[model samples]
Target: MDKIVSFCKRRGFVYQSSEIYGGIRSSYDYGPLGVELKKNIKDEWWRRLVHMRDDVVGVDSAIIQHPRVWEASGHTATFNDMLVESRTSGRRYRADHLIEEATEIDAEGLSAEEMTKVIREDERIKDPVDGGRDFTEARPFNLMFETYTGPVKGPENLAFLRPETAQGIFTNFKNVLDTSRVKVPFGIAQQGKSFRNEITPGNFIFRTREFEQMEMEFFVEPGTDEEWHETWIQERWDWYTGLGMDPENLRVYEHPPEKLSHYSKRTVDIEYDFPFAGWSELEGVANRTDYDLSRHAEFSGQKLEYIDQGTGNRFVPYVIEPAAGADRVALAFIVDAYREEELEGESDDSRVVLKLHPRIAPVKAAVFPLTKKEPVSTKARELYNDLRGDYSIFYDETGAIGRRYRRQDEIGTPFCVTVDFDTLEDDQVTIRDRDTMQQERVPISEVRERLQRLISTGSAAAER
Candidate 1:
């Protein structure tokens, strides 16, 4: 984990928020490379789930939702974490998490009373920060940010920043159904930010107060809910593995009734291996049988139902939801794609590589000039401009050619195009492969086509 964090900071991937003023706790700002990588991951997911499929349609929902929406969805009442503050240090901790950490088990389903009992009985609830004082008894802490709507301070118009994107999809279900003419067995996908006033938002960006989610609610017939749930689980698994994640680092765990959500009949979590934590959920697919729709229907006194033309039946549609945290997905990609290799020591030259798939690499390829002189840099700059319109290309001429190659390798640019004096005699330049360290001379005009082909097939064509 330390190695990964160091590499991230050194390579300009991410940084702590407000670093200049002593830093903010558990918040992060993505750097240039980090932003590109994250955008690519999100675009790929949107392409696979929305553009490539005919059944799935996407919607963008607001981040701040009506407070009554939370009341209808039960989040205002049930969305809480058990908390314990230290007696001596005054530091706060998630009580269930501390107990779970001590026992190496999950304490998610425990009640406040149950958590308080365990904290009192167990001596291991010491301050992780100070290390000598016992923590206070467990109590429920609401994790919602409450605010007033108007200039007056009153309880009538209080609002909350949405805790999850799933509720927005549910509240707007009838609106989408009416506008789009979508029937049963259709899906509404959304990507938006959610907030939580969490006591412990650690593990880097793995858990944060403000995060984004890519969630989809697949509405289907009631009896076919289980089948759809399994189908989406498989679909999500394939989506990750298809993008070059190691098969061994991913798994699907089925949830028992006790572990399932209050509204879900069945649940499955897609877990990924992280360096700091052994395994954790990357996404979840759940079977929520008419819970959200009925809640909204009862609250708003509106009918959120689908009418069947064949059977003359009218009832609410069952929902199979696949919810994935965007930041978690990006972190998983970084962890799985990271690589360090020892070169053959051709001339005592050392090198390290990121081994990111070309599709997700921050820089597709970098253009290099053999020297900082006029024509070489000019030619390289021209090539950079050409490819920059189609892909993200880096142009560097300040360092040695080998040093520039190492820089590109560290950032996982798959190829490096070098322009030298030979390009004056023949319009051909030497292309260096980052992974293999193999160089081949090719026509300068063919660089764009060659890279496009290589990125498409994950391999270069024969020396063309």
Candidate 2:
């Protein structure tokens, strides 16, 4: 965990938010490379779920909506976490998390009083900050961030920052149906920011107060909800592994019937193995048996019903949602790609490599000039410009070729293109692959075509 954190800071992947103010508690800001990597992940998701599929379309709704939306969605009353403050340091934590750390027991189902009693009785429990024995009673803390709608600061004008993108899709269901040519068995996808007032937003960006979500709600016939739910679970699983995630490190956890969410008929989480948490959710696919649309219809006094022209049947559509956190997905990819391997025939010598698939790599390739001399630098810059129009290319001329390659490897650039003296005579450059360490000399004009095919959808380079 320390190694990953250090690498992230050293490589401009992420930084603590508000660093000048001695750094904000659990908030983080993505750097240049981090932003590019994050964008690529989102682009791929959009490509797979929206653009490539004919049945799914996307929508972007406001981050702040009518307060009645929450009332309809049940977020106001149920979106909460168990909060307990430590008497020693006066720091707050999620009681369930605190309980797990102290006794290795799952405390999510416990009542507030039950959790408080356990905290008081356990001698092993001490404030992690100051190691004091005193503590406060557990209580429910609403996760929504409340704000005033306008100049009015009264209860009637209070509004909330959306806690999930799923509600936005539900609220806009009729608007999309009326505007678009979409019909039943179609989907509405969205990607946007969501906020939660987390009690313990630790483990880096794995948990945070502000985060982005890529969520899709697929509307289908009520009777077919379970089948579609399983179908989406399989598809989401393939999505991660298809992009080079190790299947062994990913699993599907089916939610027990007794513990399912209020709106969920069935829920299955796609868990990824993290070094810190062992295994945690990467995404979730849920069968939401028409609860959302039904609630919205009842509250809004509008019919969010779908009339099937083929069967001439009028009814509300069931929903199957596949929701994921962008931050968590990026972390999972980074952790899975990190590797430290010893160099061949060398003792106490090793190299760090981020073997990110080309599709998700921050930099697609690095262009290098053999030396700072005129001809080499001139040719390399031209090639860099050509590729930059199509891909993210890095141009570096100040370091030794081997050292530059190592740098690109560390940041997960898939290939390195070098312009040497031979290039002036043969019109060819040497291309090195990051993972295999194999070099291929190809004509200058062919680099673009080769890389395009290599990184194209479902291509070999993308899968690797």
Q: Which tens-of-lDDT digit does each residue in 28-143 have in candidate 2?
A: 99998999999999999999999999999999999999999999998988888889998778899888888899797778788999999999998888888988878889999999
Tell me each candidate's TM-score.
0.94, 0.96
- Poorest lDDT segment (10 consecutive residues) of candidate 1: 455-464
Taking every candidate in turn, the Cα RMSD to the unseen true structure, in Å, is 2.2, 1.8
lDDT for model 2, on a 0 to 1 scale?
0.90
Q: Write the per-residue lDDT of candidate 1 for residues 40-101, one digit (tens) a residue.
A: 77787889898988788888887777887998998988888899888878889998888888
Regions of model 1 farther than 4 Å from truth: 104-106, 459-464
Once superposed on the true structure, which residue ranges of model 2 sit more than 4 Å away at CA?
Answer: 345-348, 457-464
Which one wins on TM-score? 2
C-alpha lDDT of all candidate models, in order: 0.85, 0.90
**Which residue pairs come into collision in candidate 2?**
none
